[model samples]
Target: MDNLQLIKSQQSKYDEIIEYLKQDNSYWLDNDIWNVEDKVFGEVEYKISAKNIRFDFIKNEVLKNEVKFYLVYSLKNKYLRLSKVLNEHQFAIKYVVEYVSKCLLNKTSFNEIHIDNNKWKLFLINNGISLNKNNQIHNTTYRGICSEISSFIRDFYDDREETEKDIWYSKNIKGAKIPATGVHGVNGHINFMSIPIYYRNTVKKYFKNIITKKSWNHCHQIISHLNYFFTKFYSNGYTDGFIENLLRNDIENYLYWLGNDYKDKNPTYRCKFVSYVRTFLEYIQMAQYDKAPKKEVSFLIFQDDIPKRELNKDEVKKVKFVPEPILKQLDNNIMDLDRPQYIPIYILLRETGWRGTDILNLRYDNCLDPIWNNKEQKYNYYLCGEITKTGIAELKIPIRDKVAEMVQKSIDKAKDLSTEENNPKKYLFNTYEGKLKGKPLNKQSLLNTIKRLIEQKDIRDVNDELYHFRLHSLRHTRAKEYVEQGMGISIIQQILGHQSLQMTVHYATVTENTLYEKWKNTENLDLFRVNTETSRLEQVDLNSDDGENLIRYEYVKKNLDAVRVPFGVCFKPSKLPCKQQMNHCLTCASFCTTVENIPEYEEEIDHVKKQIEVSERCGRELWAEKNKAYLRLLKATLERVREQKIVHKNGKSREEV
Candidate 1:
């Protein structure tokens, strides 16, 4: 027999099994027929039936206007009993019928469907009946026992019109070209088998040898619980309901139980459960096509009404102090020969206000001069280093005076302990005992040492962890001090190398007491309380170049520069060069005559020149035109003084004071 005859013979046997299932009263019958209305094959009907004993089948119209039938028997039931079967066989039957419909009407191939159906038929023959040499099913010598029944159904029922030849031909051709289902070759199959086996064994070995036995046992217990649930509740003998129930109702209850009951007993259990659930979901995702559920299950929990700790003034003062003896001990220990070389590290933290990580990673090369130093102090050292976690370029911090002195002292001490050819390229805190020799101190080691010191000094009442006392706290304290002293926020930010003002603000703590004290000390009471009616004078333009002015602009400029007057002072020079040149009015013999000659311009010129000179010499850059204008004003005042002197001499010789 050819392929068509064998297919027909197999269909007959499947129909017989369907009849047998229908006759049994214990099994449920569902004659769910899917109908399709097509332009070519009008009213195509596909019928599916399932029984509880593991037998299910589908009947659909074939290409030649004949009814094609297929059946499946579950392997779990040895006696071909359909009642004990799951929904898998029924689902498979539906897939096959749908696949055949697609092939006939949509002109598509169903390779997986075809392979599955073939396996089901083979399974049936191997377990229930036998096939002859010609590949035709035979039951008690009959070639096709259910052929008459199939013919009757086809003749009386199934009134669908035949699909067109072109459509049928396209579908058949497409179906024939379907790809293979299994591994490509023997090597592929071997590799596929070997990889999974190797992975399984390796995982088992790791769990057995590497992980704690208790952990391994716990995982096994969980898996056993899942397996027990699968055997008892799942219709398909799989842990399907366990996952469904976990998603539907148990998750919240489990979290609650963890929070209330197991919160302290097994603090990590809730987190572990969440992790396990995720792992299971991921496994399912890889094995099947289903979405994982999303829910909030936090790992941390705390009492709802917790209060923050705040220190009062006296308590703060007590915490801030280091006893005289303790300070002396620390100083001596820092200078000691046998103790750990942590003095430099501690001093650095106290001085530069750098974090532990920053200090640990500090290079000798980074301690150079700053780009802008108005004081012109050569002892100033700039700290340029990297932030540990972020790995970004941090700002350079300037260390001068006390801080620079401490750093240099530490460097000298470190170098003295080393051999003669000591290079400054070496870390300022290099030692024999620490990691990264010729480099800075280790952050953790430094933290540990400080923590020990704090403990020894009994100062760790609030914060016991030395690591928690960040190196950045030094920076914060310094910033607070600067802010309290009336330093500009921008300057503090530059010193701290903070990119944002907001961050600098966090470190800065302003107090009203400090502000009041500053106000009391610096503000001038006389200036503020002056009576305008008595003290006010006529406003004079300092930019004026009046020649008759007794106070020369040059004299005022020289006096202002000599006194090193602050910006914003007010004064002007004499209009003419005195007979006693370069001499002040207090020492000049011709002072009285000059003063009497140009007394009107004296006060104005004095005030204006002083103001102009001081304004030019302010901390900020001075404009060239402003400086030149002030110089001309001074020269014009000198000329005015000279003209007045000559006029006075021509008029009369006045009496002495």
Candidate 2:
């Protein structure tokens, strides 16, 4: 074979081996590895990923010599085996040097290393490395190249093992003395002697049980809490006891110590620690073959000990919802993001008012419909997904034409690249690039991207506080807008996928600002004066005017609807059965009257007085007795209307209203 054919064969072989290494479950710490590198003596840099490798030497004498002998002894056998594949003539020349100079520098990745049928062979020949076919030193140079790459991989793994504190290392690394600090310790690691060797097996079993349902990241947290709880228990003069032998008081004391030591730590952290210990205890109980004494594990004892987040009555009134103008601007800003993948994500959260987790986990078949109709050539897009948090899947939200097109485009893109099981689509939003590229984008990745942009754009809460825009804020803004539009709480409850109306009310309901603003606008101090003398004022006669007089009734009714109070609407529908009838809503939260509606209230009072006069003038004593109650209620309703109107217009104390 020619020199170029030999080089091409070698390149293909190396590429296959690298691909094998990537697919091998045991070759690397993580099968899915990213770029990792190490610089030796600040001159020669070595970088490697699953698919690519890079070696950059400054060409200085010291560094060149260091690279030449880096790991030659260990790699000599491997290099010799690789060289044996080449023809006798090929082996006589410097094959490794030619490969590195011609292939490595020219190709960005191993897969890209192919004979381009260019001037690479001629260039290698002109470089003037002993081209005499009798040369034996060429083998040594091949071995040197292998040594440098192997040494780089080894150093990378060594650095990762040193930096990464995998929980398994604690249980698996036997006779390799446990460090001074435990798995979670900062200085070194906790000494193995501190935890009784007799109980180590049991502890491992218990840790395994705890981690069975948790993610690797959450498992680390559980491990840390367990480590701290055990260390604390042992330090408190209880080293002789096993985990099961510990009493409730012992556990409580450890928690009390946690409280005292971590006084400044938030309750969520403390609560998590307590929860881990409780789960450990429960596991211990279950492991005892049904004869273990049942121990009551309760958070009630530590309720007061653990700090909680509580809002005052007044504080609860003012919920933090994104203002309309800012949300509109945020929508525009999100659309203008550099990455188009995140645009659909933010818009989905903003428009559908669903949690990010629900949106992230949205699937293809059930949650989305790619094509709405065939004959009409129009789309009837909808969001139909289960809420991850609540497990409620009643979503059937209609999508806007523009948003539907965006989603369809993203779906098409993902489908073109997808190789998921039996379907070209998996996640609605997949990672664009990174170690996780083409996989479903995780919640943290989206959060970090959004937070970075928010900081860059200086997007803030309209209240001027340091209101960090969280992904969930979009959900809140949507809810607030719906409530302001007078949508029913029940409708919103379903939209948010909340199992309970109470949760909907607490999480997505409008704040008191809307009510406060309405009240502020209607304030008039003069309304506070009770003008009893105004009874002598002339009243308009409806019967004496033309049919245009009915406009006054419509005007009064309209104003009644406009005024909203804390109790109920001032006007009661005629069909509703109420003993009080027209005055039923008086003094209720929904009852409201503006200064503009005072005349309406006054007209009702006059009408009621006229009824009483007619009953007495007709000598119908029994009818007059019934009509007196109506007069009294009308007077009471009139007085309330005047008082509320006065308070609303004058900015009087809410207590007075």
Candidate 3:
């Protein structure tokens, strides 16, 4: 059946179940059973409805099972149909049906269901609802269902006042479709509702407006602080009265308490508490009090009183690209994958820098066939998806033939599996088996799979340091490769689907070692001369009288700032530093160059002479003069290094060797 019709059908079936369950003055599953002789005497009959067909098990004496046995048999077909329409809740339905059936059978008759109402509620609370094929129930909660069943039992079976409305602890607030009762939802909100009526209403309104997970968490934290406030100071009286006497000092004192009492807590937490509390006060002041600035009625404004902490430095540093060697290992292992299911995903991530979320949720319909590109002169394929973090929709990743081929193969695999009953046809990548079978492979699942394949035992960095293998590292690795290939920041930003250039800039971390290497090759004179066999070290006897001047010259050379430039180093002391600090270093009195560096200078002089000749031939006399002047400086430096011989500390000139 189509989805809408199927939904209607399932709802109808649930209505039937609830109707049958609530029949008679007492509800359907009440604990009151007739004797087995009732059926023989035609006093009691067991019947169930499915697909508009009624099946009576009481007449069929061949099946002498109890209430549970007949109930399961009667409803099993209906449950299967319901399960197909509702995949996520299939386990819950199956569990409830089977559980109720078992409870009925154990008592020997249908009337015993009334006696087991409390037991059933306890069962719902403890076992929580379901056992699905995918084991999703364990990752889920039944707090809402528990509260519902508890209320129902109390109102119908027991003799309790039903005046109180259900004050929900878990709900899908802030337009969230699914109820967030997981770790993100446990933000002390239920406790917050126990505060003064005025405070409770305000807090509940704020919580309902908080749409993001982060906002909800922050609200939860603020509620926790309010809890502490109610418990510590106004435990005996209504907190609303305390608000009248509240002063600026009280708020400051609370912040101070948070700082001192939770001294061991992370400083960031303290800062967040101050921030959230301040926002809460502001929210109350405007939302309820009409933006009045009265100290008595208003939440005391103390901007300085709020705790502040700087963001961690390590967290700020970005662009931690994976090393090439490690990436090579990853590629080798990934290509050798026997499953081939994960290969396309890894390659897409490694090559295209797409976030794991986008890749995991990739749809078959979003991919397009390879099209010819005049610029690239080759066919390129595209995969379109939405960026969940930024909400950038229809973001397309242009793929080369190799990556396209892998994706096409995966698409074919998905299509082949989609023909099977209940197999997913929408998601391109899905697990065919296991608890998560037929479901799109989640980010964590893909991460675990990749980690298992690559890191057999332990993942390590390029330096052999222990490293955590993350899927994000693949994106970073791709970013680094793009930067190294001279791709512009804007181009990289487009490729990575970054809305801001600032984010793209963070991924351009060129390591200090890489910077130093580039400097050595292009700018450092020491490296330039060293490459020409220039000997920076010379022999000298420490005991000789001449060695003192040698030592002084060596000290002068080591301390010079000329190592960074291309013209050569200067031998000068800071006590009597060179007057020429710029390009004039070549003509300075203390300028120095090794004999081995003479060839490079000579080659440069020859190139300049040719340039001068060409400039004169082209009738550019000014350009010729400029080249000639540069040649003169070069020739002078060469002549000085070649002929000059310094006298020793003893005043004896060295031999011309």
Candidate 2 residue runs with Cα over 4 Å from true position: 1-221, 240-242, 279-294, 298-321, 369-382, 386-409, 420-425, 432-434, 441-469, 482-506, 509-512, 518-527, 530-657
Misplaced by over 4 Å in model 3 are: 1-197, 207-238, 241-250, 265-271, 276-321, 367-382, 394-401, 419-425, 432-438, 455-468, 479-508, 519-523, 527-657
Residues 274-302, candidate 1, lDDT per residue (tens digit)?
A: 44444444444444423322332222212
Cα lDDT tens digits for candidate 2, 1-657: 697975676555544444433432422212222122322112212331232122232223222222222222122212222122222212322343345455567533322333331344334455553434543223334323333333333332232342222224333334232211112211122222223455555555665554334433355566577778777877777754445355657766876898888877666557777776666666666677232225544522344544454445555665556666667667677766665577788888878888787787666546666556787788777877755345443477777778777777777776775665433336667654543444466666577777767666777775665346667777888888777656788988888888788777776565567667546434421223344788543433445553245545444423322212222223444345555443355535555556776676677666555554544433345444544665576566667657765533334556466
Q: Tens digits of per-residue lDDT for model 3 on 1-657?
A: 597975575455444444554433332233233222322212212332221211232332211122223233223222222222123232343334445456555532221233343465456646655545643333243323322222323222222221122232333233322211122223312344345565565555565555343333444556677666555546444345555456777766666667766787656556766666566666666666433224533347456655555435665564367776677777777766545667788888987898786687676666656677898797778777756455465677687777777787877877777645435546788766643455566666567777676657355775676556778888878887777655789989988888799888877555566567556433422222222366555444555666666555444433312211243333343345434532465655455466778788877776666556544533445445655666777777787667753312322232343
Error of 1 at 596 (Å): 22
Please, what is the TM-score per model?
A: 0.30, 0.46, 0.47
Q: What is the lDDT of residue 19 in candidate 1?
A: 56
Per-residue error for 229 in candidate 2, Å, reads: 2.1
Candidate 1 — worst ten consecutive residues by lDDT sum?
Answer: 182-191
lDDT of 3: 0.53
lDDT of each: 0.41, 0.51, 0.53
